[model samples]
Target: MDKEEVLNEKYDEKLDRQDVEGQLELNEEDDSPIEEVRVTVPNTDDPLMPCNTFRMWFLGLLFTAIISFVNQFFYLRQTQISIGYSVVALISLPIGHLMARILPTRQFSLFGTSFSLNPGPFSIKEHVLIGTMTACNTGTAYAVDIVILQKLFYNDEKPFIAGLLLVLTTQITGFALAGALRKFLIRPAHMIWPSTLVTASLFRSLHHSVEREDDVGRMTRMKYFLIVTFGSFVWYWFPGFMFPTLGMIAWICWINPNNLILAQLTGTNGLGIGAIALDWSAASYYVSPLVTPWFAQVNILIGFILVTYIMVPWAYYTDLWGSKKYPILSAGLYKDDGTAYNKSLILTDGIMDPQKYIDYGPMRMDSFFALTYGVGFAGLTATVVHVVLYNGREMLDRWKSARTQNEDIHSRLMRVYPEVPNWWYLSLFILSLGLSFVTCVVWGYMPWWAVLLAMGIAIFFVLPVGVVQAVTNQQPGLNIVTEYVIGYMLPGHAITNVTFKTYGYIVNVQALTFTADLKLGHYMKIPPRIMFMAQVVSTFIAGVINLSTATWLINTRPNICTKEGYPFTCRSTKTFYSASIIWGAVAPDRVFGNKDGALYSPVQWGFLVGALLPIPFWIASKKFPHITWLKYVHWPVLLAATSNMPPALPYFYTNGLFLGFVFMFLLRRYRYSWWSRYNYLTSAAMDSGVAICGLIIFFAIQSWEGEFPYWWGNPEDQDYDHCMLANANYYGEIH
Candidate 1:
């Protein structure tokens, strides 16, 4: 048989079922020429399931968690810091890089299952950074928001078991959320997979380096690592320690006053400061960096303009900021003081009384006034459109493939296109609703009605917002959507009641986002077993550290967890706790339409408008086909947000330009050949080394340096109780 005939026969066999016998018979034909085939062995340089005998991942995760826990402990005590999610990136980037260089080749094989981590022709620098960044991005966010926040709000009363369950639930929820989109995202060609781009860049750079040098010595690599380490170490601290007046103060004003100037100045230090300006950014920086990027996205920046310059100023001028100084009745609501929840008493002569400040700022009497419900309305509209328009076709394709394939019909179909199987989503929605009801009932903190109502509202809207966020990068899932939904539906619930809903919803969203990425990791021949155990262990490690530090500050008197003003407000356990409570319970009143609430900031509203603003131009452009600009309305909003950096614009642009000019122009021109060789490894070495330095700083130096990284505890407080003690108080004794 001819080669083409053989190829055609093989293809036909693939299409047909159980044709091995026929193919063998045909190949055995005496007249047919036997073709000698050469097969290359699959590389097994870095095996995945290395010796199913010993659990390398279990050990790694255990070690990582322990280190994280210990680091967070001192970080909380010294800096009143809680670990941020990005901190994982800070540590992992370096650790992974270093390990990649030093660790022996890992291999695994057991029973019938065998997988190897082959050393690709790529460079070590890229792989190290990719691994480290992955650990950091996924790990720390879970630590700060879920672990610390959970302990802060509920540790006093909930059992350790409950906390564990909550964490697991959050993880599971994240997995389920991402599972639906796994097919579209993980499939080789569909999504651009931006994160992988970062990883690939690092890989290519290292590959170039290896090609340039016959043998990379330990000392040479070490020298390069050290150069980058100390350089970045000093550079990072320059703005934080040397220029605290600007670094710290500007962040404070930006967040509190909703100012942009402070955010711009943050670039002076190369840190993302605009994130601290908004509550969402602050929370998001720890929960998920991908979402936090919105703080600097085109639509978000445009939203900020409308909110700060237009909406907020107008509110201030209109006395909306000063409106209803008399506290309106919370119907029959009463404070912890057992007095009528006097809106008047809370309000000060039609303005929030001068102010009894906490850590972040005064709990403004009219703080809830700035909220707006329109964003949720807009988000819901956009979400439906996105899922149906873009994802709908994909889901149909998955369904078609699943129907013809005999694979576990449910899972395979869901994996390919989860949304197509209406039953699957229906089950998830029902399950989530059921779990939420049980949570409120078991906790007995929120009324049954509140739980049911909150879930109903959340279920109705979370899909649209959550789906939009997961698939195409959109800001529809901003906490504002959940917060407002809760507020609008459950206006009568206490602040804490509302909090439960927000926490549940956000955790659910986060779990899905992270898990989706993990699916990709699994499919790409990355170790699923390792990543899974690593994540689970990392969570508990972060939890223990976060809880201990939070407890310490709560018990610390005077300087600790104060209800006082300015920095104290910033430090108060009550502020974070209260924010969670309000977000979960109040819903629309506090989150959506409340102009005074952070969720309704001019920035948020502006984004809402910008997202929808394109519709009119889109339609008009259709009518006047000659107007090329109208077709590109989205560009202006993105440009506006990009340009909103204020004082930092020159520096940020300069930094990018400097890096570009130096690397692409000067160095490349001078040593064109060497550029390909050194550039990749250089960056990998630099990032990995500095990341290690940063982790050491965080765990060894920063922990002991008298400040915690996140919001663990007040370091200045002289007499704070440890976390174990606080947990004992909350769980052991009836307060």
Candidate 2:
């Protein structure tokens, strides 16, 4: 059947069902096994909707530039604010419609082309395209870190064009891989990227005009979204600005003020045993529980309970790696006397001096930081094994059947538009690879071969990582392991080691993100060609702006990345710089294994543990068919549960999962109609509200001095959560 016929039959069936029943629910007609996608995504398309109109380009470029500029500008700061796509989606809809109404619709001829200045009406396709562009480069590019690190720490000054090229190459290389791997990640019906579903749900809620009788008693999705968003925005002022204690209410710590162990157990910064976060930002920091599947949440919960509650407590109490001396949860590296590790002491001209390194005590970390890295290692291997065991053959079959198989409804609808040719991807991939090689070699960042190795690693791992992300909304990162391999290969080349790691790690991430966006486009029924063009343009714009912004900041602000720079003190970059010193200047073999007082050889066993952990579950799943829960044991997700530790405190998970239980579990099972219709809408609303409120607080209120008076909620001396002792971590005044 033709695309139109497929659309007609499907649309007719749904319309007829609604006409007969008067209140036909989509969840009742959930033929697709993936319930989330079925409820959230519409299996329909308007192929002739003027998606390539000037309105798309204008608004698309506007938001893409704004998002890119804002994100890159704030990236170096201690407290950074990210502007998410939901914000863009929320703001742009009215602007788009307004422009459509205002802009002249007269067709104009330029050169050989004739195009209208405005489309008939604002299209969801146009919105998706706009979002795609912004989504393509939301954060600062991986290579921007390289640029900033070089300028601030290494004092390496390359040409602006070279730095720009480096950023562009690193950022866009993944787009090529995403295009190539679309069959495995995007085409498969089962590969429902959960986050995209939320985005899809948001657009549908905003644009869809009709409402069913079943939705009469319940508020409209858009109305609910707006009310919730406004509520979130208004509510965040307390936690975000005025009453900071509202963010993490550590009531248990308030009960026993002087008790260190109790404080440690209950502190927001510590184990977070009795911590309760009222802040949505804090609540949703690590995991978006509402949109994230219950199975995934359950896996995360299991992993979190095991690692945070059981393993960490055991390791910390036993003083593993002398944990009692440093903070119980910290990402900072340290020395034998419990002072911070000063890489400056052992460095000569930005590279490691072995004799000076010997003079400084071996690199030490608290057991929690050490184990998180171990967990990261475990997560990577488990991802490989887990995907292969569970999804390997199916992926292979899906790959083979791409041409022959009967298409899914969504895929069938998408056939109305032209597909992006494979050569386009191959060509882009080759060009990006060539540029990456050129920039690295020409600018003396690394050897040309190192770039190739990095890209090769990205290609090899993209499918597994993408599959993991598709299934669980969690991607097991290649960052740690990539560093280890490159560090082994090119010892003492700090620049090369980090550059290699970024290329390998961030490229895979970019590919997965692009694939996710593509999946969103698929769900929203955007044309493949338009999606490709939108991403390409946006990536280019975002990359240039990122490099330019970083360059501008480093030049304009002296000592920008150091403490003397004050608020601009590069907190995150310091960690990035530390990683370079650890894995780049000082190779992994020296740093990780038992050597010269260095403590963390056991982290290496995570590789073995991760690889082995999945096999037993697979075996047991096969051995016992009736025991269904055993089959959902995803080691990658579980291992990665504590992946964001050190930065993501235990309370983040505590509150997030509790909310997940209420919404994703209880509401989803009991309140089926409400959950099916409004669940993803609620997630989007919450995120949007939090993001806007955060920006306003940072810029409008908190940016000015003496905005809010200090009170019990916003304490001047003690910890905000009232857990002074636990947050102190035995050391009285450590950040």
Candidate 3:
């Protein structure tokens, strides 16, 4: 029989059963085994059943907006950027759960075709949607540093203008880059969007529960919500004045409070031999414990070891040994007067110390050297090639499918969801770069040639970094820092430098990484618009918060922030400023210099290194396809210097063991159906708690000036031992 004939017969039988109501019991429908499984994969072409989008708006959009603004105030603590997506997910849970009970729709719209949320249990799909919206929030951390620029260079005249321009620059550039490379990035089966797994899991649980719901009771979530909120507000203010030790505990790590032995042990000179207790900075390094599964822990381990231990020690040791001078040493400089030079004053205080001004200041202009033209050309070529090769077929298929409905899964998915194509995106990217160059020129911040070079270089290099971040979760910002060295080598009269140009690379990597992660959420039935809006709202909010705090605390050198000869030290500005300098100026010199120190000066050499490192391994894998050991070895992680055994020890001891213990002792032992349902939410709850705690600690103590030891010493506020800032009530009096 034909399928239509069979459906007609079934319809007649259903009608007959309804007519004979006494014999046909409604409760019997619940006994069907198929009804128990509640699988909701929609037919590719079905139109959605109408349901109230108003409820979705409240649950997903509004909730995310409020939460994101507040969370940005705390966690990211940047007025210049925000974390709106976090709130989106939090609010989504309530919406999905509540809406599941009332006006549930099996049909939803995708390009006018119907899709299904697939009627099932109330779950966490709302969170997934929200996460997707916040994807663009990735690069704002760097872009928002324009606030600092405004204060120091522009006399804080147009903070919002700088911020807005930077934001537009980053977004336009990223979108252009992503569009150009979309085919290669999105189409590759080998490129597993790892974050997609998390989003998919959340969506599946929320919309398809044949059994019990896989989440906590509303009360448990509310309890956590209250606890985190109270903790965030309370701890944020406690260290401000009352019990100043709240900040002390976070900033200080003393071996002994008073003794000579203690001073030697706890000093920053590397002689310390104290049992290390977790400070906010060290503890904050522990974020790997939350999201990194056992399989991906190596990248986090390497970052901790390389930066926290090896690179830092090497840099510090070079400063001390003096025999083998690492060209770029500490944040401070030894000036002609023989006292440590004050960098904050030189950079931000707008004051020339007046001694040796002509001789020393000459080299400072090299900081903004032009070399981006070459890199930009290369980047443009790579982007075009990438898309043409990977996306051409897919784009054609999509076009054909749109006309005839003869589309496969990918095409159908694409059709239902229209995204701006590569050409449009690339145009925006180039245009933004041009506009930003003009802005820099107008402000007299960088000469047009120097600005173009920076723009070109940034544009060119963003491609490979984007690829790495999208493909592998690992990042290598040092790769770009090494590139700036080459920029210095180009026969230029000067350069416009930021501390670490590699930060640009890091931002690019993060942009792609976060976007791909959000896409995973997209595929799992989260609304793209919600995720996009949430991310924008959060980014803006974070930018403002970060800018205000960063400026007030980190910019006002020798007053709000003391650099040198001040009684108390403030390292926040020092650390931030030095970091920019190293990447922007120093690293480039080291990498691309004619001097002995410029060993690997050109930044592209590192990219070449990164590319070369993987070839042999990839070739081997292709040549010997059946090697199980080879399959286990992730060469990208290994080649990128992303694996460190040291940090993994504690991680393995705690989280590794914990995951194992839970998997074996609890999950396997219980074997109950309910266990599977609630596991994801259980994990999410813990994540939310930790994020809240870390954020509170970050704002209340970490950003403050002159806490444990200010970056500089004030001559007036000196007692023989500690000191104070100028405006204090006890100013010039010894504590």
Candidate 4:
């Protein structure tokens, strides 16, 4: 792709202002006042530019399909990883320009419309739209979990059509909310969706190049990205495949391999006190070290320390929730005797039998696992309180101000393109609801009222939660709250419980995801109509691919979703299925209410604890003006830090925070020039390289047994990181 001159010459900020001003109000400020937005995002907009062209759809849909399938394929594994949209950013740019160079430009009439295969150079607008489409694959279609759960665990005979519509309705339904909330979430200069800045910065790096300058050593961003990506690709082989133990270098556990206490305190499966990840996937898994602001990462670090170091250890050592019967940390459901919970014994005809439950006894979890669930409860309420205290008035004023409030520069520039009509969003919203009702009722998933109630839950919480995410990169989830509501409402229907949670939780999540994408488009100055079209089409395609991949895996792989399946251990579904047992088949009351040995009863008070957590921070910030960090104490981000610990290793946080301190903190502060020039591009490169390499390693070699030579690095008879004692329970030693 041609670098500096072509881009600099083509996208000059001429042909603007007076042309756009005749039709729309122009903001006096040409630039975004927000520094993060201003530096990363371009101030110019070329409305006459063609973005939704043939090259975009061809490449966009292609990448979307691959990402969706790969994410869904890995989601069932023990250590699941996602291929980020940054990969799309890295790979699509060159392909896009190539298509522009090679494809025929001859115009043709199709159904009273004229179109051409090639449309100018592969514009940044097209890149932005293409990235938006691939962003749809960032999430594994949430509905696919229900499909896998039913097929693998519940043994239900649901039609493929049901799962397909489930994926479509649950995912695309959010676009309606995105359309409605653009003013509050996207247009506001204050609502700096920090992650979107990375995308904006990355696109700028990919397109614009320095012909020659001593500043960045005259190296173009494309060249820098390629170097970093290639280096990351080669480095991942040791950690990812050949020497898998490098993923978790639990050096602390190596000290006292035979001691239960030391292993429990330091193992990858335990608290991971001194463990470190040499792998990029572990470091950048939950929180992107390169992208999240220093303040947010600091808050996460505090939360992680409190939960993993202090709270969890105290609970486990003190024998809280029968902690002594299990390991300090675990990713499994258990019986009272510390054996694996026999889910099959309790389930009869896909429903929990009351007599069978009594005979089988209650399910138990490790202290860290149970407490994380409580933290989940607290995080949701904390989000409500935090948003109300921190941003209530501003959000309210924006909504009330509506179009009368002065639009930001991005908003004003976007005025050149016709906005997506309200009727379009409304049509999708109404259709998704109807389809959801049909899919649930026809397939006997959840009742019609349950669907309404779930949607109601989504509507109520979406705004407050959305506000939190819009400001901070962190988003509090709805899983805990949704499960509790439906578990108590309509218990003893396992599939229905997950179904309700999926609708209530994922509907809100999809809405937020769509809103974030809208914000990204807003920053990039892509037309709202093109943004909408790209989102809908890509989402539908990704959903189909997600469901198809899961179905194929279940149909072909023997013992899929089981521990024996090793690589395809279906670890995530176990957690999903565990929720079914706790909330659906068994009922939350018996488990979390007042039954004998109901150790988790007090955990429900997290709702109250969460509601009150933000008030102290708000008052402290107001009372003690000198203490600036008090205001930055984001309770939702804090509490939700360890939410993924069962699946996410502790080293993920430690290593991520460690690297975050280096890049986001030290480098950004100490070396401002380098940080501003190449930080985000480095992130994009690292992500792209690791993702591509991981895929190659899996398909080419890791899928087959003995493909990798066993050695000290790739151990055959012990824990990968040599935390052997950490595999057993705390006391009575269930090894």
Candidate 5:
């Protein structure tokens, strides 16, 4: 048959399948909740394409290396960019089709089942498997942060084997937990992880062809994606390298160069209240404008304004903790004498010297920095309280109904393959736990009791965090809270403190991340066994590569955390190092305890305040049920707004929230058809384009010792963004 006839036949088959499955029809005017919007056509189990094919593994490894190296490199940079999954999804499509066309398709028997080196045609399942592998590897392993801390800050180099084992164990343990929770997270139709829907759309757009008769808009999503992708790729170069000032427009700082407090409130390097950022890289560092919902973005802005604009400025002007004695915004720990804390003086052989620390007096932080930590404590408590208040009943109902409820279309499609067994997950969990425990005790110098306690913390937080991420697309990180608990318990042991925090915080994050991928796999109808193997194997490979890359960078680069390094200043590792000092070397009791006069004693009350903040909102929602908007006031999300104040520039939130409002709220409401057709496709395109350009710039230009010529566009000044507060006293102190 001709192409048109074949396309018509496939369309007819899809309609017949939808009718047979009793699929729910969706319309633009449908008032049904977003969670209830089902696919127009149910997935069919046909062709039975080979999932664990040679081509799949080959591409998985290739991308695993690229993503791991790129992510590790970016993790150390000032901008702290992560390679998004869309980049992988976009790149993998053409490559998968090419492989299908080129590779041998000879059938072979494996354990009495037939398989092929190449699938009959490039299948969606194969595409998903490759994406899954990419997802598992696209971000730097959490253990690398700890390793960087040990090597760069503490001057202690962990053996390569030990570091690799630690990375593998922590990552796999989380995967095991996700595997155990798959039934609850992956099977439920209502647990529509919003990001996965975007991935699904992208996958279908790439793999499936639409009939011209049924196409609503003259422009296809793929065409729009490619056009936008190429445009973004070209546009990024202007702000990314040549004109650094485009990243952060400190207009107020430039206009009023003499006023310290004014500069502190508005400058990007200071409070970042009135800064305008033109760079997408700076704005989307903390939260992706494309993924977060409008309501969440609004709530985040609310908290951000309250803290940075009002509270921080008021406290600083009032000289709370004598804030005027130091720079208005700095992550650096200070001393009672109003000077930078000399870390070298307090360290002897990479361990804290108690006498030296005592002689050095108490460590002090910038007022804004302390406020960020306070908000973090509040965010942690608010997460648990908010989830329980808003989603607790729904979760319980899901658990009860999961046993007997009729399968949704996606679930029905997934029923073609056997579910992964309980023992498989349990065995992996046990093995991972043992490996982690051994690594902590032997290599990390963590106590056995501490290791168990950290694992217990992960177990307790995983479910709530998972629920929040599955529903809201945001995670209230456990880093600060975990550090507080562990620090208080194991005072003066830096290694133990960091190790505990790593296990407690990263384990939950990894589990949630893995569970999100599982939901993606479920949405795409990939077999559970194949998905699990892909993640496990790819994570291992990526972990090794990440560790190697980190090692190479640290060894080759000198003065990593100094001003001399410019973009390679190791800002992330320095932040992690400071955290270790606060929670490990100094101890929370010393900073926030009821001492005669502790600098940040008042901030400790944030935990209590955070726990109670969500109660009023929950009660208000119940009392005035007609005011539907009240239910969406998420305190955890609000608190998260201030969490990035230290590492991320203030303009990040301002610009990102603006885009979120534009796309998620305005466009979605006023231009529903356009929003539905192209919103996520636009997001995917931008992310892919930016990531590809970043890679090219790093490898081709930056790596070759080439430099953009010094000119007006590329200035030689350090603060090219013009974000520095012009107060002589503060500037001198920092310099």
Candidate 6:
């Protein structure tokens, strides 16, 4: 029998069962296993739908340039932002439909095959390809930071070609790694990549217009999406611009304005405890409330409470690392004398002056800042431990099955498309490796062995980190660990330290991001080869645009790294530069080793502590299998949650968790029908709205020296939310 005949017979049998008289129907309360409802992948045999069309390429290049420029421009600002993928995915659909209506469908022959510039109709595949292109340019290139560091801090000007090559090499190397892991990561049905489900549902809602009678209670997804998108866009103006204080509401600080301890505990710009941030930008800064599961949110919440409310307060009150002398929450490193550490005083010819350093005294970190590193150390170890304990066997099984197994439903459907050859990925990897090696050795002034070590570190960690991100939509990046390793290996070479850290840490991040995109392609059933080509091409485009944008910003902006710059104060770059001094120039041994014997010296043991932390949870889950909650206790999530103090606002956790519980738990459990239809669409709409409005506000007003007229609504102090705790005397200095 034909496959179609078999499917039809199964469908007819299901209908016949429904038609049976006097049959008892299973209700929601029934304990029996529900019959699996299989959805046939749509348009599997439709070849006329345009995917790799000229229109796609044209629109892709246009959007990639816009998004890349916007993203790179924002990356240098105090509040680093990126264009959301949903913005691109949502915008592309209408543009694609418009092109389909106008473009001619003239066929042409290519390599003995018939093709067309406009293949009969617009396709979801083409929409996804466009999204893929936009997604590549959504984040600032990692190498851009390295180039900025060299120029701004070290005063070393790199040739444009050298910078371009460095960016291309790092970005492409990650893509190659992602491609190599396609069989293990992308070809699995269970690797749901929860985030991609939102995009997939949005695609179906847009392209598949034929609604059934079963969808009677629900509004059209597009209509609902538009309503939410517009509402969010309008709502954001008050919090995002005119009344910026709406983002952070510290009621405790408002009530007790003069109490130093209370202010430190409750202020948004202070320790950020007992605060309620209303803005989506502030609430969603750390994690997306819509996509992250309630269980994960709960775990993160518990960790935040323990760290911020308990650990941080205890250390601060006790004056650990002389916490009472400095602000409780700061990323800045200070001198032991409790004054701000000036880099210029200690630097002689772009390298640390040993005599100047000895005279200046050792650097001291804020109590909370030191604690973040300790927590980060614990998070890193816990990630490895948790993955091995919970997922090792599953990963091993998947690798073994990749050789012969064709069990996954998505994989079986995807077999129709030609696979991207392994040699293609290998060739890209080899070229990227050679180029990166040469750049680092020659321009970066690093030994050949160090470059090789960096690449090796990336390769070793990518798989484990990829597995963690694939299963849980979070990745514990190798940034801290990479710096620690390289610092010890090649001390006093700040440029080489950052260069190594970029390759070692960012390569893994880029690879996981690419793999996620590849999985999105898999879900949408785009051909593998086309996805590969689109990713590589778009990445190259992003490299050029990002470098150009960064160069322009640096050249045009004066006082780029100073206090006078305010919003353009290079906050992120300063943090990066600080890490180089602490880890590379001064050396970790001086801070955490026997020389200091400070409060943070004990933090080095967190690795050993973290390794043992997950064992109890794993054992409990196995021993008490019926206690279901025990299994959900993910140590990595718990440990990682504690490390969000410095960079992220505290209310992000408190607010996002509240929203997640309300949506994922309350709405999902009680209003199943509504939740099923609108949850993901609502998320997509909100993200798209906020992102679109942000770009308009920046480009139209802020970038052109335009500002909202100062009033109570728009404060001149930049503390319109009144979240600043006026207790500068309590902590000697306010960052």
Ordered list by TM-score, greatest first: 2, 4, 5, 6, 3, 1
lDDT of 2 at 83: 92
For 644-730, candidate 6 gives per-residue lDDT tens digits of 667786777888887888887898889867777788777788887888788788778877877888876578988664645533425
Q: Supply the TM-score for candidate 6.
A: 0.91
Highest TM-score against the true fold, candidate: 2
lDDT of 5 by residue, 1-735 (tens): 854345445654564455444423533322213531343223444425457787788888789888888888878876566777778888787887778667776888989998777654566678878888988877788778888888777778878888888888878888888876766676766677777777777776666555334355468767787898899898899787777777777777877766776676677777676677777777777767767777777788899889977887787778788877777777777776578887777777766666877777778877888988899888888888987888788668777775436456567667777888989989999999898878887885587788788889888878777776676667788888889998888777676788888888888888888899888877666788888888988898899989999889878887776788767887777777777887887778877885423678788889999999999989999999999999889898888887867767667888888888888889888987777777777777777788888778777888676678777556776566564553222444553
Candidates in order have lDDT scores of 0.38, 0.84, 0.39, 0.83, 0.76, 0.75
Candidate 2 has a TM-score of 0.95
How do all models score by TM-score? Answer: 0.56, 0.95, 0.58, 0.94, 0.92, 0.91
State which candidate, 1 or 5, has the greater lDDT.
Answer: 5
Q: Which model, 3 or 4, shows the larger lDDT?
A: 4
> Model 1: how far is 50 from its true place, Å?
5.2
Separate clash counts for every candidate: 75, 0, 69, 0, 0, 1
Worst 10 residues of 6 by lDDT: 31-40
Where's the lowest-lDDT run of ten residues in candidate 5? 28-37
What's the CA error at residue 178 for candidate 1, in Å? 2.2
Cα shift from native, residue 624, model 4 (Å): 3.8
Rank candidates by lDDT, best first.
2, 4, 5, 6, 3, 1
Which wins on lDDT, candidate 4 or candidate 6?
Answer: 4
Candidate 5 ranges beyond 4 A from true positions: 1-50, 77-81, 110-113, 212-217, 404-407, 553-569, 594-597, 726-733
**Per-residue accuracy of model 2 over 1-735 as CA lDDT, tens digit each:** 854345435554554354335323333432346788878876545576668888899889988888888898778887888898899998899898778767787889999899898746677788888878887777778888887888788877778998888888878899899887777888778888999988998998887655655566778888999999999999998888889998889899889867888888888878898788999988888778887788899999999998888888899889887787788777787787788888888878888888888888778778888888888999999999998999988887877785436446777667778899999999999999988888988888889888888988999999998988997888888888889999888877888888998899999999998899999888887889988999999899989888888788888987798788866887778778988988998888777866556678888999999999999889999999899999888899999999988678999998999999999999999999889999999999999999999888777865564357889998888479888777555555464
